[model samples]
Target: MSENTADVTETATEGQQQPIELPADHPLVKTLAAQKESIKELKVRAARADELEDAQKTESEKTADRIAKAESEAASVPSKVADALRTHLVALHGIEAEDAELFLTANDPELLQKQVDRLVGQSGKRKKSNFVPREGNTSTAGASDERSFVRDFFSGN
Candidate 1:
């Protein structure tokens, strides 16, 4: 019975010592306690805002990368189209390689043909190289004597 009484008194003393009161005298503590709910709400809102900002940055970077890739591809399109046009003119139209550039800017077939004729006429004005062997050197073995066998091989004998 005495031990039970002592335990009851100790519990009462501990309960008395533990006061469920805020530090009312401290202004800062009182303010923080008063605004605790609002502070949590603000923190949550701030975190959400930061998350949204980071997401926007990520999306913007991705968009910028996509735009950069598109710009690069766009820049090369003209050259690719020009090369295809040059190939078509050279293979199908029998335009000279040196005169291909002049026809690239021409829109219609008639204009392109006119440019081709102009280029052919200009080519006629230039003197031809005398590299062609004379009729006397028609023999293949004799032509080999005039030029090196390697040069003849490379020149498509």
Candidate 2:
């Protein structure tokens, strides 16, 4: 017999006939036939994975940027409220613009008003002394002294 027939007979005697013909038209067979095509398919899969990773990275960066911007805006709100209070005080008090600005910037108005009221109540019960009245006609010397005292007291000088 021929060599091919002899090998087939030997394989048949071994209880199995494993077919070795290449089916060039079969989808799986065709895929395995071209090494360059297989490599190209693998590269395409790798590129898809890289694209997914880069998309996730860009999304995370946008989320982080939004969070940072929100935090910055939230931090400025209190300062904006404080500035509004200062402007209101300057407009309402008929005070020296600088003095109103300083008072609003330096102290809580509600707390300062409570303290001043308490001091005024205490002064009403006491006899007049060197302390200048909040509203009264006074000598020029007395006015200068009171101004100097107020300036020195506020400045801690």
Candidate 3:
């Protein structure tokens, strides 16, 4: 009996840390306790509201909701695919991601390529030394480039 009592007390002590005592008369403590109680009440009310709303929903209404959600997700797939393609094209063309996002909005990769090619072909501001390297020997290759090379696509000659 004494051993069991000792085990119980040990467990209780283990569960507790030393308390940081604040005066109960403190206005901040009072407000904090009030807020805690208010949170509990609000949580209860929200749960009850959800339960009532769920109870009010018919089987058909739930099915319709699921269908609508699925439809919305389905509608977004093309946009996601196009965005992925755009990102790939941006990296491939050595165009800045921000520049592509701002200047290129077309869904067609070929069209976006043309747009990027035009931007690269037009802008003579970018120096040979300023080429953003993509693949091997780009620095050595771009350093001797004639002119008209885009960001960094100096493969042969």
Candidate 4:
């Protein structure tokens, strides 16, 4: 027997012994074939959609990485500027460099300058008292007869 004929005959005998026949032009068979073709097309489209989605996701991740890097760089800029201004403050003021942090309260350049100037002006005022004592007061109590209260007090007499 032909392979196709044997397959149909065997399947029919194993079942109800009734032949399964349908005209190719039957509405139900046409509809089933159309559905199968639609399923194949849908599977192809689904695979293409997955590929497109993966490409889009990859692009989005790269964009996100760039944005994160840019944000980090932007954040560090203010910190670097503040450190530079603090170093300037420390050099100009001749005070501890750590004290410069207090003056970093403002981000505005004009305001920072104003605060630095104010600190410098205030520190400059203190310089007057740092001058050396009079030469007469330089001697010790028992060494010189200068005998002034200021001299005695400075010499620890």
Candidate 5:
């Protein structure tokens, strides 16, 4: 079995490709080396294309980019102001922190302030209740005895 395995291994090695060697001055070898250098130059140029293009941008193009950034920040101003207002009311005016969402959507600041004032005013008042006081016997032993007595009477005990 070992001799057969050796023969199989020799056959496999004989079937594999051997590396081709060429002289340094050969035309094919020179052409391949030049192509490799060209590929490296192409990869570097591709990586730098976007940055080089930005550096060469015209004044108007740079201005347009700045304007776009400013517009995005301007669009967020109202919401940012609302958030600051919500935080101020909750921290300084005694509004429940969880209820700040209501103030965020109020169209009129005065109306929101009025609502907050009312809420804070009522916060100090006693909580009203519809609960009424009542009294009743709570013992269960007498009921249990009654039930047992009725059961024994029925069974003729």
Candidate 6:
């Protein structure tokens, strides 16, 4: 009975000596406790914003890549079409082989035709409406009178 009482007294003394430490006065502990909730909320919002930015960046890159590929394909089409157009134009222009080769190598057909037409018109071969002489400027009576004079001069009686 005395041993049990002594053990009980010792346990009670230990419990009394080991006071429960309440976190009421530590500034760092208080700050950390207060910041924990806000930090978790901030982290969640930041993660969401980062995810949205990543998704937007990925979409933009895909669109850019698609546009670049389309442009490359489009560029190739014009070269091939231009080559076919050159062949057809070379035949239609009736140009000498060497000159046609030079023209096809150097210029587009429609552009060459425009240049040729411009130069040809400028070469004075084209008829001008204002420069053409009038046909019936002299009267028929004047011509007849001139003819009688010529007949009299030629046939002396």
Q: List lDDT for all candidates, in order.
A: 0.69, 0.66, 0.75, 0.75, 0.73, 0.67
lDDT tens digits, residue span 14-79, model 1: 776542333457666678777998899999999999898767787778789899999999888766
Off by over 4 Å in 2: 1-57, 106-157
| Candidate 3 structure quality by residue, lDDT tens digits, 83-103 | 787777777778886777788
Model 3 residue 99 distance off true place after TM-score fit, in angstroms: 3.9
Best by TM-score: 3
- What is candidate 6's lDDT per residue for 61-120, written digit by digit as tens? 878979999999977875676667766655665545675565445245466556545544
By summed lDDT, which 10 consecutive residues of candidate 3 come out lowest? Answer: 137-146
lDDT (10s digit) by residue, model 5, range 1-157? 4665576677678996544455688778899999999999999998799789999999999999999999999888766765566568878976665666654355455655676677676775756766666546455565777788887899997
By lDDT, rank the candidates, best first.
Answer: 3, 4, 5, 1, 6, 2
Per-residue CA lDDT of model 4 for 1-157, tens digit only, reads 2665787878977886665566788777899999999999999999999898767787778799799999999988866786677667768778655556665566655677777888778777867675565855654547545556666789887
lDDT of 6 at 88: 66
**TM value for model 3:** 0.47
Reference-based TM-score, model 5? 0.39
My TM-score estimates for the predictions, one after another, are 0.31, 0.32, 0.47, 0.36, 0.39, 0.35
Model 2 TM: 0.32
lDDT, residue 39, model 1: 90
Q: What TM-score does model 4 achieve against the real structure?
A: 0.36
Lowest summed lDDT across 10 adjacent residues in model 1 is found at: 16-25
Which portions of model 4 show Cα errors greater than 4 Å?
Answer: 1-56, 97-111, 126-157
C-alpha RMSD values across all candidates: 22.0, 23.9, 17.9, 19.1, 16.0, 25.6
Off by over 4 Å in 6: 1-66, 106-113, 116-141, 144-146, 152-157
List runs of model 3 lying over 4 Å from the truth.
1-22, 26-28, 96-98, 106-157
Q: Could you tell me the lDDT of residue 81 within candidate 5?
A: 65
